[model samples]
Target chain A: MSFALNGRPGVSEATRERILRIAKEMNWRPHSAARALGGARADAVGLVVARPVETIGVEPFFGQLLAGLQAELSAKSIALHLMVVEDTAAEIEVYRRWVSEHRVDAFVVVDLQVKDPRIAVLEELQVPSLILGGPGRHGGLTSVWADDRKAMLSVVEYLAALGHRRIAHLAGMPAFHHTARRMRALRDHAKRLELIDAVSIPTDYSDAQGAAATRTLLARSPRPTAIIYDSDVMAVAGLAVAAEMGVSVPDELSIVSFEDSVLTRIVHPPITALVRDTFALARQAARSVLAAIEDPGSARDLETATPILTVRGSTSPPPGDAIHETV
Target chain B: MSFALNGRPGVSEATRERILRIAKEMNWRPHSAARALGGARADAVGLVVARPVETIGVEPFFGQLLAGLQAELSAKSIALHLMVVEDTAAEIEVYRRWVSEHRVDAFVVVDLQVKDPRIAVLEELQVPSLILGGPGRHGGLTSVWADDRKAMLSVVEYLAALGHRRIAHLAGMPAFHHTARRMRALRDHAKRLELIDAVSIPTDYSDAQGAAATRTLLARSPRPTAIIYDSDVMAVAGLAVAAEMGVSVPDELSIVSFEDSVLTRIVHPPITALVRDTFALARQAARSVLAAIEDPGSARDLETATPILTVRGSTSPPPGDAIHETV
Candidate 1:
């Protein structure tokens, strides 16, 4: 058993194969509790989602990422144990319990917040983990990420080219690491292009919130001629708000959404969107976590492909008169 | 500790509170495994999703259902342990492991298939469970469900009243019990109305498949004046297909989707849909499973409220010439 499990290469191929077959027939899988206690592989990974339960369903991001993570984990016979918590404090409790009990071999962390404290806990526990966002301030924890700054910069540049001088970004959750990253990029790029009246509104990633933000932004004095949304669901809702308000898209106002979904394409004047495969990025993150588990010292931060802008009917040159008086 | 855990009625309220508070302060939690071995409680419920891994993310049904499930479970301080598997065989294995390991107190099962083998497995194991779909073919498992037939009948009646004689239903996977129910209802209802042309097409619930189905159905001679989709995603995709084909919705054709989503209300000619509170149904199921876990013999099957149809821009009187000719 040791020779087979540890790959000592001492037994003949036929003998090793026969032993493995017998073990399978006998249902002799390693018990996770004992394995965890011995500081050995539990053959399981933990992903704790810290978000309000009611809102978790509508966002496509987590579901897509889970599917991507499963693609790699299942092939290696690793079980993904999922837990949902309402906030950061509860999420921290989950990590502590899992670490103490050796319930999981490693952790796959996501939804990074400002000055994430999970890093310190993970470091103290000597647990193997992979963060799913940013090439930013992680405390030596291996991470796989996409370049959110570059992605945000591309969106701003595209809108600017379309003659959108005054723009408003309706973003989700300002405290999140990626949201902050995108906001910073938008500010920097818009300044570089000499565009004035660039603004952002934080939302809770709901259609209702997005619609409300669109209505409030449009009703303001010197209202922006162009708008960008952080999510497909929000973008779809924002478009509905515009339609209900009788604002003509592209002719009077231009729109862009950050995520590409089927929701984006079905709306009137299909939304111009930033397209990137969440599944692919998640797969890379899973692979990196697996690598770190086996050789913790060798793991390093890796960045996946940046988002690419897909031009569609929703974005065009801003309205001739609307772009001026404000800036 | 024993008195508080078991509710034995032998301890003072103040003493119990103090014990619980100290337990919390010390970061102590019951050992779920030991509790399970004593046939007490694991304080967790298992949800095993057996869907194709690649397609799990795009569908909003599972996500919404999960959110609804969490709302009830979290209130009772029960952990929702989620596992995603690829097939029934693997799902059965999960049930066995969870039952034997005492990892969960009960299960919440969805996506009921014909002659579901899961029923027999759950029966054999004597596991407490709640089926989220039909009150049908369960070997003695409690179930919570809504009337899909009544929902479909309402949709057909509404469209028929709108002067759409020839209609088509673009349904999802035929193996799912609810899909079969909806299909049967469509056939029966349409036959009673004596609609000249009625057809049902099966799809895999992907946007691409939805578009393909729409294209094929529309290319026929004297193509149907109206169509119903099994999901919000499919309906949205179908609408996009109609747009691309330059077919004017509500005039040249009408569309109705079975599930209500932000997708339905945000499209160009917003899709008319059958609306229901999935979150409520899921809550009932969660509560049912919890009750069954406490006292299995007392659990009973429950049927929730039927869907309410929401009229929108997509459904109206069909083209002047086509409606009468089909009749």
Candidate 2:
């Protein structure tokens, strides 16, 4: 009749048995056990998002991904702890505390940079983590990434088919490992196509930065006829700048962007860009993280999201007048 | 020399003293001792967003608020754990687990509904939480909200000033606390202005839902000349529906929306909508949550944001040919 079991004092056996039986019957075993297990020793998943919140609003990709992760975690009742750090160093400190204190069962690492310090720390601590956006330098950790290289190639091929010879890129930070991969893919695509003077200007993925970068590229001696941006916000900004400068899009210049946010579709001349289902990416990352938590060996699995091109109004063949003028 | 402490069988006093001295110099205190001395806990501040991820993408408000929260939390080395719950009941469960297990120090609650169940749970647990868009039901918990009533009134007055009498509103769920407050305010404003036939349709805040509602209103014997929506996405959907029906914007109908996201500016003939600096709202929420965590008494302090109207190309006077042609 007593609630005590295995020398642990609590409620009556009937109540405890009823609760345990109900939990098992309802498939609430993982979360209930996790909650009963207590902290620094419980089974909760953690996510360390290193990007600032301001950046997240401007960039639609992460918001979608986070949503996907939330959807996956909520169903399993496995808690997803999100920490927003100022920089990579702070992220490392967060991971260190979470791992050493045994506060989290696994980690979801995002925005991996070239020569990331987190890789070493994660490896040394032997903590399980799923990296979203792979750091090509790391071979040991499990990674879930969008195929940026293939996406970039697709973008180039699509633009070339439209006869855009002078294409410029407004890329994200050069220091980012994925940025480097994307840039390499872009250059190779342009080279193979025998295009002259394929240019890339690196910006920090802000609309203003994108606009400013676009302005710089436009001011060149032989102005680029087409511009590509890493994010839709940047592309939107570039569009605004082009509008303000009296440049008619798809007539004087064409524009393409990534992310395919609401902005892309709503803009006057909808941007032709590569689109990835952010929710799918998030779900993938969340599932991968859960799998890693369930079996640490799952950390060896690599998942890549293929980007699809959505053609809208912003792209067209070079203007006949402009082509004749250039000739 | 060992690293032992007072009466503890560990390391020597000399080694311990050196560690303590270095810690003191660096202002780095042990978490356990710091907890006793009222130092910052490593626990994160969690946000349980009750809305779905698909909804988050279309709504710009949450993104801005999260960014603001992130900015504030990052400065204090506190993390923000975000979980998306399917419904209010699920949200309560998430909160319970987070509080009982000390997963987070506090929470920021969003999308408050009338007679919300979370209020009772929060009260029972006495957990520190700040609700965005307050229900006006919970007096004890801290609430940070925009002046929805005033915002609704302002939009009504703005449309009224443009000489539009029949105005329809595409609103969020009627059960939502903000929706009730906004509806009441809109109705009161209409009565005060002596405007006839002001109507409102409650929806789930989705583009498809908004479009369907807009279609119903447009089919009325006397269609509304000015339509105001609770969200930009809804407004965008309404615009699309109008376009499909060959209704010219600002010529036959004027549309105004809430929450000026990038969608507002990018759409053709930019939407004239209610604008608030989401960044500021986010910053304030983050700051308020941290303050509440530090001093639970601060929960009584209510911070309200004022909504500003951004006039774009969507609003104008009623067409001159309508009444005459109908007659």
Candidate 3:
């Protein structure tokens, strides 16, 4: 019976088939928790988010990623255990608890930070874990990352081509590795291109912060001809800020968002944005994590497609007088 | 030892304390899976959403509600089992699987439909379930609801008071009970207030649909002076549509969103919105569902505060000559 039910080598094919048919007739299904007690797969993955809950509502990136994860995982009947924590400490504690309880088969970790403590703890646990952001620094864990540096460079090149000499970037949470990479990308390229007055402003990725930073930047003597936001919501808020201060978008100011979503397209002068398929990125992460769970310590780091800059109404050559543009 | 570990009446207080101390020293905590085999609580709640994966990203309401639910549930160390499914059938399958496996202690159901099938399935399964939207039609299950009808009435009353006679409501999916309630509310009052050209346009709650509907409406010889959207994203899309057609907001048109989020507030002309404490509402639902899990069949229907209409820059008396107005 054990052999038949467990589909082990001891069971003959005919007998196993007969037993499975009988079990089906008896309405028998393997209990997920019972299987976990017997050291079987939990058939679930955990995601512990460390962002403030309020930010989750407005940020399209997280939602799209979650949808992609769900779409892929649910196809295999794998449950997603989601928890939003206040900070990294709380997030790590969740990982510890879930690990000790054997509540999840694997974890999908996001929001990778500089010198992230969660990476060390996750490594120590020796559980199948995948980091959603990184080409490096996630020791022995499978990681999937998009090229943040390359994506930023494309944005800068596009803006420079549009004759935007003075540019500003609204970066998210300076402590994040991606944020640092983006800032550094802007700095390096800005120098190489001889773009004067290029500046990066760190923000919490909140609309309030985005608006405040935009207001401060717009008030400067030689304000940026183009402003790049790290997220779509911030770009919208920056557009609002431009309107509030009587700065017409694309005409007086060009705007670009690092991320793209319906929020970018639905605005008055639809924002020019760097478009990556976040859903596909998350789906790849889900597949990588599932592979890690299936073959622990074997899965390798995966790099996804670089975000492509899609130009729309909100970006154009800087106004004729501001930077002397040809096109 | 079992009594002490389980915290049952058979164990003496001193013995239980000593056992717990030793267990703590030994790093012995209850295994969540092991506990489930003994019919102990799963220490988790399930929320299976039945929306297309695409919509989840841009919708602020779901994220905020999730944040609120997490904030309340996690304080007591309960986990949220989240799943996004294609439709109600998939949602029901998830419920069945989770219930059979004892994967969750209770279920928090959202997006209540008129004559919902899940209500019956939940009751039949005898699981502790709470509907997040409903005052009626939920069969013997606990529910938490805000007054949708009252909220709609207030928006219409406010618009009437502002001297807007031509009102068009861009409603959400028509199958939703709340959507029906909102449509009916507008219908009932539009007659009483003698607001001619009042119409309700049902949509799938996508920004694309919102933009299309707005374009169609704006093309009319006598375009609506006021437009109310069921969601903040849709409202933002509508505002963009007005901009494309060169209709000045709150001058040629007034716009209001039934649900307010950062999206509504950060736009060029900040949208007037119906503000409800969605976070608080979700917290209350979490509490109610937890109570239902603790004492099955003991939880009752809970009515939360009605949404209040918040007037911002988006709403005003309809364009001067379009409708006669005072103040």
Alpha-carbon RMSD to native, per candidate: 8.3, 8.0, 6.5
Clashes in each model (backbone N, CA, C under 3 Å)?
0, 8, 0
Model 3 residue B189 lDDT? 83
Docking quality (DockQ) for each candidate: 0.24, 0.25, 0.36
Expressed as tens digits, the lDDT of each residue in A1-327 for candidate 2 is 111122334434554455344323322212222222332234467777777567777667767767788778878876666667778888889888776556677888877887778888887877678888763655687888877888888888887777777889899888888788889988877767656657778888987788788888777767888898988888988887888777889788899986787767756677898888878887888888888766677666464667799888888887775444432
Q: Which residue pairs overlap in candidate 3's backbone?
A: none
- Per-residue alpha-carbon lDDT of model 3 for B12-118, expressed as tens digits? 56555654443343333333344444557877899999998878876888888888898888888888898888889999999998987778998999999987999
Model 2 scores a C-alpha lDDT of 0.74
Residues B139-255 of candidate 1 have per-residue lDDT tens digits of: 689988888889999999888888878889999888888899899988887778878888889998888898999998888888888999999989998898888888888789899
What's candidate 2's DockQ score? Answer: 0.25
TM-score for candidate 1: 0.87
Give the better candidate number (1 or 2) by lDDT: 1
Where in model 2 is the C-alpha error above 4 Å?
Answer: A1-41, A216-222, A322-327, B1-42, B215-222, B240-246, B322-327
TM-score, per-candidate, Cα-based = 0.87, 0.84, 0.88
Would candidate 1 be rated incorrect, acceptable, medium or high by CAPRI criteria?
acceptable
Best by lDDT: 3
lDDT scores in order: 0.80, 0.74, 0.84
Interface root mean square deviation for model 2, in Å? 10.4
